[model samples]
Target chain A: MRRGIGFWTGLGFTLLISAFLILPVLASVIAGVTANQFVGLSSGLTTRWLVEVWANYGGTVLLSLRIALATLAVTLLIGIPAAYVLARHAGVTARLVEEALVMPVAVPGIATALGLILAYGAVGDLRASWLFILAGHVVFCLPFMLRSVLAVLLALDLKGLEEAARACGASWPQRFLGVVLPNVSGGVLAGSLMVVTLSLGEFNMTLLLHTPFTRTLPVGLADAYTALRTEMASAYTLIFFVLIVPLLSAMQWAASRAERLGR
Target chain B: MSVAIRLAGCGRTWPGGSIALHPLDLDIAAGETLVLLGPSGCGKTTLLRLIAGLEAPDAGGRVFFDGEDVTRLPIERRHVGMVFQSYALFPNMDVAGNIGYGLRVRGVARAAARRRVDEMLAMMRLDGLGGRRIEALSGGQRQRVALARAIAPRPRVLLLDEPLSALDARLREQLRQEIDALLRSLGITAVYVTHDQAEAMALGDRIAAMEKGRIAQIGTGRDLYHRPANDFVAGFVGDTNRLATPEGERLVRPEHLALRRSATGGFTVVQATFLGPVVRVLLRDAAGRELRADVPDEDVPAPGERVAVLFQGRSLETEAAASPA
Candidate 1:
């Protein structure tokens, strides 16, 4: 017998939507990489604009990497504990805390950036450093990271492992670092990858608060677009694709592995 | 090498005023495996956790390991090993790492830990499977791994919470025997929790029958089965047909009721099922009290046949309405 109408229809719909969304990005990226510079779609392969952008704005690209890495580190340090506590601690207080953590996800990113800028700018200190940008990125990404980590943590057999580790004479720290962390490694890695990708591509906050030294790749590309350089902007987008694709692919693979293990 | 564990007036009540465990007094002798037998919500697992120091009891409760007070000690300091019902082997670690975990926690050298793990694996009959990942192991294999992990550190006490409940019937029976032998060989005091009375009887030196956070009876398997102190214990320890009397109660086991060919007997067989080795006869008395009698398969009566049933004289005694003061 057939596997039912819903199953085939679902698969067909998924394939149709995936092609609809992905084909355009693929075609544009290819054209951006191949078209001759400044002539848009003129014949022949030419990566000359890519080379120039790399040579000139390599520093901005590295800054983006640093920002993304810093954001990832900060999110993990804060979000994991929050997620773990939310998952492990029982009672109404934990429920309230979980709800509060989820509130950030409901807020629009542009509004969050605006509020963060206003709040930090009101302090009138450290407004131009990477710290401000990092803080903003953290506020925006904390919800996703916490949600991701906490979902996995909630699914885990926490009490069982904790009891097993304690029975083994493991100290509290040893239990957390050895038993607990290893069990949630997939969740933590997934959260870190999310923060990295989001922070790297973040444009709203960076555009509102970009400086000479702290210009992220997205902000730099926006600035190049403002200057009416389509060839250059396309080149910058190509550069971004090159840098983000590998990390995104790696994260996707890790997530899929975790999902497969679960299945 | 028998160890003794004592709990003095132990009780636990949650914050919302729900009692998880009521005041309990128990003495488990060394080299004996005591199974706490009860149904769901009976707090058998809670009692095991309390003694293991995974949970703390409220005021006026104390636990003793070898006559030393350990009521307030955290689980790590209690020197007790607990096997979870789910087995809870660290999925990230291979079988060897999981078993050696306890040793590594206590600052044992890798060489020594591995050596102990090797012995534990061999004891659990998992000698060559140490390097295999826990996820790669079958359910029975994982259960053995969990047992090996708990016993590797050689703690003073071992607490098992429904350790064999996850296995199929054949595997559960086999593992139950192996586990009993292993516990006997190690001479470690063990408190096992289970809802299966058969398992409790087969594995326990003494069985504690619990009901609603209180111990109904604690005695040898024979005593608990043959001489249960109350209706709850009587009905729990075996298949007891509780018959209401004018004064109090009478509980009779299926084997205690004899089926014979007589019209003057207490009851007549209404139906009979030939259950391979034994025959089950359902009978109804003059007062319409239904009783079950188990007879040998060869003597089983046909459907709609008449059979006489008899009960021991002492089985007619009525149980007291109230629990012992």
Candidate 2:
């Protein structure tokens, strides 16, 4: 009887926790679709706000895609080698390197953003441009890319695969292209997706270092909020939300597949 | 087909006080299987890796392949085939792709590579398994795929690092014979690493026993079994009952002992055990010093039974100093 009661309590707690987390998103979706606009509430299911934001608000969408792709390419080039060294090397030096890579992840994103702004903002001679925005995105996305790829790299059986390739007369580059790359491709995809997501959602760094011409999606969205463009801002948020939800879901799906693959 | 690989003072010491291998000289001959048999951490794997050029020896040491110094060459240029303890099949590739990896890397045309892969697949008895992903393969299947990959390019040398250690006993025994036959048929100079004495004796044409970063002894299985070089080698190569004589030492194989029906001399049977075809009798002297003997089942002795035993006087006792050289 006591076991049955305990089971019921646990199940109830899980349901309530899930509901608590999901309720706000559900409410926002209903509000987004149903709220009365200046055009007509009787047509109620109108997408006028989405159309207005897409047409007149800003070029936030384009900026977000650009930053995300650049971050993806740069992060992969840096993260793969960092992960390989950490995973393959043994002893104190490798451990120290691993911890150093993880240090930025332990730091708050706001701290990094502020530090960049101070260094490159009014005090530094460099003017804020798309270049500065990309630089910030790279810094912000580095930890995420490294962590995800490193996890996969560590989980792999390096001696097994590398030895097999070496024995098969595979040159180092061939081994990298054929054996190492294929095994780590899933991790790369997942890490690249993560970098893109982080770049797209970055608000703090974008706001601090953004120029009028170089504003990212999140920064533009915040500017819209300050100017009393709540409805249009909400529409922009919905579009951003639409783009992000799929990406995040895909990431979750990939993560679960990685788990099932058992590395 | 004849070849000889000479290791002229090969050595390697990783950072942080781990001595992976000590400077050593040895020769490996073509169409011969040399098993480096030792306990874990005894540098057996390190020796195989060094020979394969996966790891370089210390600056002064050199590795010679077929009379050519290949120590500085990269692993690919060395053209050595290696099978790891883990199967190491490429997870992303189908069985065919994994098998054809070496051929493709050697710049074989894609169509020709595929044909070679098919031939290797059939050779390894993996005909229909070509399209399956590595993840879909069973342990034995994966191991065979790895074997096929290693043999596909017909490398001059084959190195196996504890190849059968991962399999169950029955499978290990079965595959040991298969791999032995395969290596012999290919006429390749092979170095097999394992701590299993049974495996070493069963597969190695000559076995090099190692301990604590040095070779303990190198001999044919029968030679090492009957005439081990030292106390460590006697204990490691196979089971033995060792006794200290007024001289250096005397070791006797359990089976070499002859158990008589009566205590005609100073020996007495303390215990007896039936072990299928043979009966193992534990003998002792007046000083409670213990010894063991293995005789045919019909000559079985009971506990507390008195027995006469004799020692054979053939041994390479002076050969101890020359070992581990």
Candidate 3:
């Protein structure tokens, strides 16, 4: 069959949009590998900038990874049960508590950081550690985790399933592990990936909370941009792409899988 | 083994003070099958949940299983098997896993649980489908798996909450027969809840017809069919036509009224539809009130024919044994 004008028009628009979004990232990566950013790709690509960035800033990358995983762990530990309780009760008090948990996401990140610092800055040791950065990330990421799991739990026949398990002689923990957790595993996975994704790229709050010794990837990227060469900064962006692109894809895939299962 | 159940002054009221059930006493003998029959919002399910220990009665209410008070115990300690209308089978598990879950919860050994699961699969006529996913089964097969899952641990009581309502008519009838046989063979105290009168009649040793949070009547199917306690029970348990007899208003089933062709009769046959063994005849009287009569195929009457409707069962309302309340 012959293609129609509508198909070509749609194809043209899509290509235009893709180029608009992807061309800049491609240009940056190409410049990072090139011998020099000023001469562009014709100067020949080299791994010199990449190696230099890794040598000087690799600790920031590892620090970010550690904080992201810790954020995920803390969210999973507290958020799943919180979401379950919130979804099941669904009273005015539960709704109010959910709104309070989500307040961090709604507030400006810098303001949230300020609030946390003022509240706990007197603890000198905690303030000077990477754990301070992690605390900020958790506060920002917990809302997403709660929303994801809460949506799944609400869509389920939770009461019926629990009652069925109860009648089958399953104790409280057994029912939770056997019936509740497995049913919402998809949501939990999606939420975990999302928390990690947000924590890795978190900048505004992390900037305020991080000490010089506790600097994260995003803070290091800012340092590379403002205080280092252009090619080194682009190399930092490339490193970030390497770290978080696959995580974003997995998060999208997991969310869609959860949606399909809900159907 | 079986258990006798007794509920003394069991009632339920929501937090906002809406009554779901009135304070009423009920007793089910050991190995008895009592079906709670009602329409939507009639509290039949609430009554069943009270017995299953999934719900608690109001103040001063007590539930006894084999004369042991269990009102404060939750459902997990009650050893009751419950089958839901939605077939709440865990989707993550296969058919065998679903059936064996209760067994494993009871600390049954691995080999014993597997063997019991197999026995339950065979009993439910799902022997070869044990490894299949819950989503892969049809509605009837899923409900059968739910039954197997509930009864695998051999609980003291079985509670079914509209277990066959989701299936088509033919499948429902087939499953109803299977459940009837299962209940009889198990010899376990069972409480069945459904809005379907035919299902209650077929499976219940005695059916409790509920209306407005009260037990309108509780009796055998024959007793309820032949002698309804009130208008609500009369209308609920079977199809009935209210007739303005000289003895005030009388309730009569279609089979109880016989039609005879009479040129001078005040009623005329509006239509006759063939329904397999029994043909349903619709008639309109002089006052335009409608009546129906179920007759054998050999006694077919043409539409628009004048006929006299006769009360065949009570014969002018003389038998108190077959009278309406």
* TM-scores for every predicted model: 0.90, 0.88, 0.93
lDDT of 3 at B104: 82
| Model 3 chain B worst lDDT run, 10 consecutive residues | B315-324
Misplaced by over 4 Å in model 3 are A1-3, A245-263, B315-325
lDDT per residue for candidate 1 within B97-151, as digits (tens), equals 8998999889989899988999998888898998898889998999999998888
- lDDT comparison, 2 vs 3, better candidate: 3
Off by over 4 Å in 2: A1-16, A33-43, A122-126, A246-263, B16-20, B243-249, B263-265, B312-325
Cα error of candidate 2 at position A206, Å = 2.1
Single-chain TM-score of chain A, each candidate: 0.84, 0.81, 0.91
lDDT of 2 by residue, A13-57 (tens): 999999999887665554455457455446477577678878864
Name model 1 segments beyond 4 Å from true.
A1-48, A247-263, B242-250, B264-266, B312-325
lDDT of 2 at A241: 81
- Sort all candidates by DockQ, best to worst: 3, 1, 2
lDDT, candidate 3, A87-189, per-residue tens: 8896899999999999998899999999999999878788998888888999999999999999999989999889889999999999998889888987888
Candidate 2 true-interface contact recovery = 0.88
lDDT of each: 0.83, 0.81, 0.90
C-alpha lDDT of residue A57 in model 3: 96
